[model samples]
Every structure is written in structure tokens, then in C-alpha cells.
Target: MAETAAQFPEVQGGGSLIVAWQVKGKTVLVVGGGEVAAGRILHCLNADALVTVVSPAARLNPEVAYRVAQGQVAHVDRNFEPSDLDGADMVLVAVDDPAASTAIWQLCKARRIPANIADVPPECDFYFGSVHRDGPLQIMVSTNGKGPRLASMIRKFIAKQLPSDAGRAIETVGQLRVRLRQIAPRPEEGPKRMAWMSKVSEAYPWDEMCGLSEEDIGNLLRFYPSGKVPALDELKAMRANPGADKEAFDGSFGFSVGA
Candidate 1:
């Protein structure tokens, strides 16, 4: 057999989980019906995926059971067959049977389906990761099929180091995107406006910056190519002075002309 070495980076257990695939809105087939299967489904849904699980094994986690009952999942009560992977976007096999998992792996490969075997890393295309959540913000940690328990432990440590309001800040920024676009400036001016907005956000509390009604927030500032920037023009005029030595002061000074 040919030997190969693959590079799998250490997971931080806090941030920096790299994705092999983005399965959002894609079909995923999970083979097994137990707590492990439930966990796999939970993470899949967290990415906003469409999931289907093979049934007839055992009870699932209560959360997964509830999601199934709520019509958020589809169940196929049966055993593994290559046909089961037909049209599947991805396949996850969490059965305790290593042989079964390996078989599913081969079948998936033959069908060109992306496969993950929870217990058999050699057969998996991707692995489930330890996950950390701070509200809407999630950090996924994967050791590329090693030390999941250690990953969880590391996640706890990293979670403590993160700012509590990170998720809220992300949400606020996401909410601000449309408004920013609607008031778009000239292409070259966009970066300057973004810099100013970022400074304003950092100077103010998240709640205060994000708390205004959408309309009121929209009206707070608008950027345009024809925008009257008297203060900016004044600064530019000052910079035009013969002995200003502008480049020496540009980096350190927060204020700038045409910035």
C-alpha cells in the first residue's frame, strides 16, 4: 500500500475551526439513532442544514427528538445500504459497529458522497468538532480525529478568555450591514467611512450603538460622493500648508485630511 502523510493542524478549542465543506442548505444523511447521532444533527442544524437520520437503533437526545417531532428532520427507519446514500450531499455514520461504519465509508466513496465515520477516522472525510457557543457566536474545535475530550476541555478554557458580548457585537454588525449599504459612499470613500464607523463603535458601548431604532440609526449618518464634508475639507486645506510634514504625522494621528 502507498503511504501518505497528511497535515491536520491543532484546534484551538476556542476559535479557528476550518471547514472542509460548508453544508448549509445541503442534504446530510446521518446513520445511527442515539445520543451521538443527536449531537451530529445539532451541529448540522447550527449551520442551517437540511438533515435526515436513519432510525431503528435507539433513543436519541431529547433535543434531537424534539427537533424530529417538530418536522425539522426526516427519519429513515432501516439498515445501511449503498442506496441509502443516493443523492445524499454528505453522510455521517455514528454506529458503534466499526465494520458497519467502514462499509458505509466504502459505499459512500463508490457513490462519490462525502462521508464521516465517527469511530473510524481512516474512513472519514470530515470529523465532528468540539463546539463552543457564546450566544450567536460559535467556535468549533477539531483535532482532526484526535482527543475530542481534550478539545472540550480546551474549549472551556478558551471560552473564559472571550469577551461575553462577542456574539451580540456580531449580531449588531450584521444588522448594520444593510443600513451601511443603503448609504453607500464612493468606492474609495467606503473604507474611510468604515474606519470612522468602527472607531465610533469601539468608543461607544454596544447597546448604545445598536440600540437606536432602525430608522433613527439610518438617519444618523449617510455617505455620498457629493457629501458635504466641511470638517474634512478644512483638514485637507490645513494639510495643504507648505511646512505641514503630513506623512510624519499621518500614522500616529487619529485625525486625517481626506481620511
Candidate 2:
């Protein structure tokens, strides 16, 4: 299935490239209170973007309403105005009325602001794809606005296959990299650092290191070349001990393996 997706890129619709945006401390204008608008608000909030929702609808999603109460979001209880796009970094128009959506789209265009209109792909500057997040790790799957279900399925499948402690392990590896750079004997040690990183990539016991503190990680790195990082095969053998329980270990790491 993966090979087929790679061989037939034309089947996926084109027009936009998938890229992650850095939205922290930015402002986002959302022009509706419907479910779609609420979903967008959640995504923006997760990215640490300051969101302002302009809508006259009776109510919005409970999560959004709660945020408004907590001062994490600003809710303007009225219809959207052109001026709502005044200082917006981006816009989302998710009103049910087509005419309203079109109007908002035009306003966004006039202001040269990137916008997305739910239910109208042609008006979208970008499409939100399926995502799976684990701690600091996030994986996004997209079909270029062609097949949302396919993207969702791929996201779920990959979510299950990821190691429960993968996020923590990646952070630990990052710290190791920083340490290596600081202590490199020569400035031309790029290749040597790369080789060490490659070797340790599959050699660490991810599950065991899930609860390791910063000090523990630092100590481990100090003995890197002294066989501190165990081989994957060796870790597997250790996990096969009679007292070892895979399900319990996975649960401790917050992974839903059975899903």
C-alpha cells in the first residue's frame, strides 16, 4: 500500500505544499462558531497562537467557550466585520452560509491575508490534515485535500507503530547532539558526530529511558563509547525475560498498542 502511494503521486490533488507553520505568539482570526470553526480554534490554540473568534451564533464548542473564560481566547459575540482581519496573521471562515463564507474570503483576499473556508476547497489557502500527537512528537498525514479518510487511516496506522517512548528518546538524542557539539575535539568532527548519532539511533532502550531524568541522560552520554547504549537485539532479549510484561510496560509509556 505504501509503495503504491509513492508510485502514483498524480492521484493526489495538487495546488498546495504541506509545511508546518510556526504560530506561537501570533494572532489568528476565526470568523465562525460552528463545529468546523471550533476545530480550527483548537488547532490554533495548540500551536500557542492567540485566537479571536467573531460570531453571533448562540454558542461555540464547550472547549472554546472554556478557553474564552480562561482568557486564552477572545470571543466577540457578533457577526464578523471586515475590520476583524485588521491584525490577523491568518483567517478561518467556517460559517454555514455560503454567501457569508464568500464575503469573508473576499475580505481576506483584499487584505492579502491567508484564509481557509471550510467546505470550499477552492477558497482554502491550506487544508488541515489528520494528525497524531504524542508528547513532543507530532505526525501529520495529508492527501493534498483529495482524500481525508485515507490520510486519517494512515495517521492511525502510523500512530500504533510508533514506540511509546519515542518522543522522550528523541529529546534525549537531541541533548546528546548538543553535548557532542560542545565537547567535539575538533571543529571538523561533523562526520564523526553523525556516525555516532546513527549508531545510537537504534541502540537505545527507548522504553527503559522513558522516565530518565536530565541528569540520568547526561550521565549515560558520558559513557557513550563505552558500550552504554545497548544494541536493539540485546534490548529485545532483555524484554523477553519471564517477569517482563509488554502490556504493562506499554501502558506505563502511554501507548495504545491494542488500538
Candidate 3:
């Protein structure tokens, strides 16, 4: 299955590169420096993973190493050790330690821990992909560990489709959604009990939060009748009307429908 997929129809490049990374609170070991290590660190931070970066020498990115010194990250100086995998869930052996990293790779494979060994193809369990972030959303693009440059170029393509302001609006609504569910009368069925919830998305006005207070969400909820919440499709439409070409509607969540 794995061998054929490597050479199969879409897995080569043109397919939807899909993967679910189990990263929340998982321990990640990153070794090495320069741009590669910085990129990996940022990716890990996005996942909220517990990352421990090991490096012998320091670089210009003091904030990178600062996180380690401040105990936000665990750093190991000098060489890579076999026991480094003591409690690691994911390992990234990045650097010029081909021999040492290959040894670490063998150890990870022995323990069934997923690991990526930089520079050595055979020693890797997986590889890093290009990534994009739209506020709370994260998208990763990979070429099955083959083409990094192409992956980056694909990221640019993704950037064009996503609205620059979409993330902020979504995040603002998400926070309100959480709070709204808690105070809602039929809390368990909050989604089904709010008629205007979807329309609210069409005009969330994240930038004009200058005019909103915590009271606005409460007042809005009070106006909603019982057992009449909005559906996701409606909310999506209110965000970017699904009825048409699915572009942002004039009365979309970003603009006040009454405005």
C-alpha cells in the first residue's frame, strides 16, 4: 500500500495532500538551526505542542533560544543522545548529525515513534510540509517530502483564495459562539435556538469592535426566540453566500446588514 501510493496517481504531486497531525500538547524534539529550525519551531508553536529544541551553538534569533532558556522550551547542549527519546512523541533530527541522527532514527523506529531525519531519506519516518495560517485555521502543503519549493509556491496559491480579513472575523465570531452557548437558555441546543446567529456573521464588524461590548452578544442572544438557532450552512452563506458563486456577499458578516 505504502510503496504504490508513493508512485501512485495523486500522491506524487497533483492530489489533495491531506494529513492530520496529532500535536496538541504532544512532545516534539527539534534539533539543528538556521532557517530550518526556526520554521519548525513556528510550526510547532501553531500546534501548541510541547517543543524541546536542542542546539549546541547559538544563532542570531535570540528569541528562539530565549524560549528555551526561559524554561518555555527544553534545550540540550552538545551532542544528540540516545536517551533523548525518553518521553518524546515526535522526533525531528535536523542538522549535520547524519550518523548520530541515523542512530536516533533507528531508536525512534524501534520504539515506533514518528521521526524525520533531515538530509537522509531512508532514515526519515515523515517530512515537514509548507504551511499557511488564517487566524485560527492552519493549512499545510507537502509534496510527500519531495519538493519544498513547489510546496511553498502552492502556499502562495492558497493565500490568494483566503480573504485577508476572514480569519479575524471568524475568530471574533468563534469567541462569541462559545460564550453564547454557555448563557443561552437551551444551552445544550444553542445552535438550534438562534435565528439571527447566521445573519450576525454576515455583519460581525470585527474592526468596529470599537462599538461592541460583551453586552452586545448578551443582548443579541436575548432577542433570539427559543429553539431556533442557525445552521452551519446558513452561517457559511452569511459569511459568503453559498447560493451564488460563494463569494463574500455585500450583507456578509463583515458588513452590518442594517448598515
Best candidate, lDDT-wise? 2
- Decide which is better by lDDT, 1 or 2: 2
Clashing pairs in 3: 192-229, 193-228, 193-229, 194-228, 194-229, 201-253, 202-252, 202-253, 203-253, 204-253
Residue-by-residue lDDT tens digits, candidate 2, 1-259: 8888788756555446778788898989998877788788988988999999997637677766776778888989899888788899999888888998998998888889999999898898889999887767778998877898999999988877776666776677677788877776576877776777677766654555553446554555555555456543344334325235454444533453343
Sort all candidates by TM-score, best to worst: 2, 1, 3
User: Can you write out model 1's per-residue Cα lDDT over 29-141, one digit (the tens) per residue?
Assistant: 98987778888888888777889988673456576677778888887767767777877999988888977788888888888898888777678776677889866678877
Q: TM-score of predicted model 2?
A: 0.74
Candidate 1 Cα lDDT to native: 0.66
lDDT of 2: 0.75
After superposing all C-alphas onto the true structure, candidate 3 shows an RMSD in angstroms of 8.5
lDDT of each: 0.66, 0.75, 0.66
Ranked by lDDT from best down, the candidates are: 2, 1, 3
Q: Could you say which candidate leads in TM-score?
A: 2
TM-score each candidate: 0.67, 0.74, 0.65
The parts of candidate 3 lying over 4 Å away from their true place are 1-17, 58-72, 183-223, 226-259
